[model samples]
Target: MSHVGVTLGVMAAIPALVEPTMLRWARQTQGYSVLAAARKIGIDEDKLAACEAGYERLTIEQLRKAAKAYRRSLAVFFLDTPPEGIDTLRDFRRVAGSESGEWSPELHTEFRRAQQQRDWLIDLLESEDTPVPTAWSLPSSEVARLSDAQLASRIRSHLEGLAGSSGPTTSDRYAHSSFWVSTLEDSGVLVLHTSGGGVATQEMRAMSLYFDRVPVIVLNGSDAVRARTFSLVHEYVHLLLHADGLCDMVTTTRATNPNTALEARCNAVAAEVLMPAAAVRAATESLRGRPVDEWTYERIASAAVRFGTSAEALLLRLVNLGLASRSLYEQRREDFQRAYVEQERSAATGGDFYRTKARDIGKGYVRRVAGAHRRKVIDSFTAATYLDVKVGQITRLAEAAGFASASGR
Candidate 1:
């Protein structure tokens, strides 16, 4: 073809006419600056800037690349404006003292992903004519009327009933985080764990979505198991009260402080459930007469281990219960916080891939999908989709969920 004909053909290539505002919104909301987004999209930085400024348009291929880079659907860009986003969850972290700040894009992404998973679960159960179990809740007014000890005792009894034969009271291993998660799952709560990418333990220990049915709790998998147990109960309290949000688990304020009263209540409830007032008192009976300053670190740590809690949490509860001095707790708080930070920073680095995936996808969820596959209600591809794994990995996932494969491998 002649040069003129070839040039004409090239000029007719389609352009992706995305709204500049939408492009900018997607990039910014995902925590990507223009330069970083351009790098990820494999485009010139100036070109991306120009596109966002409405001075340029992207080719269809380039826009596809942008969609992948932004972790958004290609169809979202065609809308007249950016759609109303997922901003409804309350930001409770602001009350967490100096730790209050903006969440990372990773956290935002995980929140969106978790909501999607909840929807998927609902739909999956519905397709099978199975009713999605509704999680029990207490009225906010009723919750407010109960004392921390009273509410904690009620919740502990409820969980023990749900756990039935495998309850903490009967099993030595109920101290494990997995036991708490399993018990919550049995009670119809969808418990999830994060991959620990951008949701740092300091930023958010856990978050809950308090739907009337199938409330969801996403724990920071990078945290220590014992710490996660505390967060699990704390977030569970949020679900019970029908108050949902991202939480840092920093309940330094007393319940009297209006701003963080809810967080404080949740923390108090978790402490009481894990370390009952009577149990704690009996465990520390020998140290009762000692001055708070004289209560050795070894004694505090030993008691904490029995309850599957941190030394700091046990110490603070002691102060609250008049068993330890507030001044002593304040003196040791920084050291405890520093050590936890270090532990979190070094978490979830290397692990067996299947087991890690199983944890991220809760064992209960994995079992449901596996059972469906076994019953031939869902095919291999569908099972893989539900479990978020490859078709070949379904068997391994089943094993990780603590059962033999349907084929008995």
Candidate 2:
């Protein structure tokens, strides 16, 4: 192969100078050490160190290898110096008495990736002339005027028509979460249900990010369906108010503080969405004639099933409606969470790539990327990069996403 003083063992080397500052910038931006970055790119540690120190230059081929390992383009290695990194998005998951941890590496990667996807779609929507999305940014007080029950009724009506759930019926674990996810997507909310890194221990339940006039929700796919469903609607509430942040409000609650008033509102919205006061009153009319003190775990779970909600959500509903005392509800919630954790441990893994990414990558996002590819707006490589999947899997992934969107619509 003809070469420009450098060889890649194939096509001619594209004439490019790999700036040492850029090399150091890329490695540092991703929080990688010299030795670690070298190992990642399969390069000699000493050689990489020299490049980063500006003592030696990286050949075009070596630069390409480094670029691939860093998940960046070769042109990035040619920057004059170092460029600033992506802006940090807002984090609104903090609640009183809870540790508000910063983003983990996996979560940070996923967050940045999601933001980039949002960026891509914003460009696409503008060029394609997509209609302006309706933002349900109502004053929280006004929404409460209809009473929480009435607002929930309206949301329920919206969700029922948002997507027609017909997959595994009540038997499947993903039934509830799938239903909400479809409904969310159908209502123009982009839902991403990945496990972030798919790591079990540090899995975040869900997070919402608003961008370019649209809201995107990311749910942890590895979590149990019960918990994921709670997260889904909780984030839906955040999206409604155009509030952007991360949260893990799965199976629990915190005291209402003016500082975290939004979390409280979103929490209430989630509870009402899943089990409104009207529905709760109707369902618990028989139990009410009895006594709140007599409510049992089995009873709460049974009631939860009717509303297609989790026992925790149902318990919260009961407490909010004063049908059950706070003391009893908390006690039952503790028991419920323990049992639920054990059940999740024994339950099978959530879903495979097709079922998971179908919702995880988000149907709204998948269709836009797929359509972009078809229109030559983006190539397969770019599509796969944005999807965090292999190039060959693009078509199948797109099909699954399309099917999901169609099912929801």
Q: Point to the candidate with the largest TM-score.
A: 1
Per-candidate clashes come to 0, 1
- Candidate with top lDDT is 1
Candidate 2 regions exceeding 4 Å error are: 1-87, 93-99, 135-175, 195-203, 250-259, 287-294, 345-350, 368-395, 402-409
Q: Residue 221, candidate 2: how far off, in angstroms?
A: 1.2
Q: Residue 258 of candidate 1: its Cα lDDT?
A: 51
lDDT of each: 0.79, 0.68
**TM-score for each model:** 0.87, 0.73
- Candidate 2 local lDDT, 112-187, one digit each (tens): 5677676776777786787645443445565657654566566666667545543222635466666777666656
Return the clash pairs for model 1, or none.
Answer: none
Q: State the local distance difference test value for candidate 1.
A: 0.79
- For model 1, give the RMSD to the true fold: 3.9
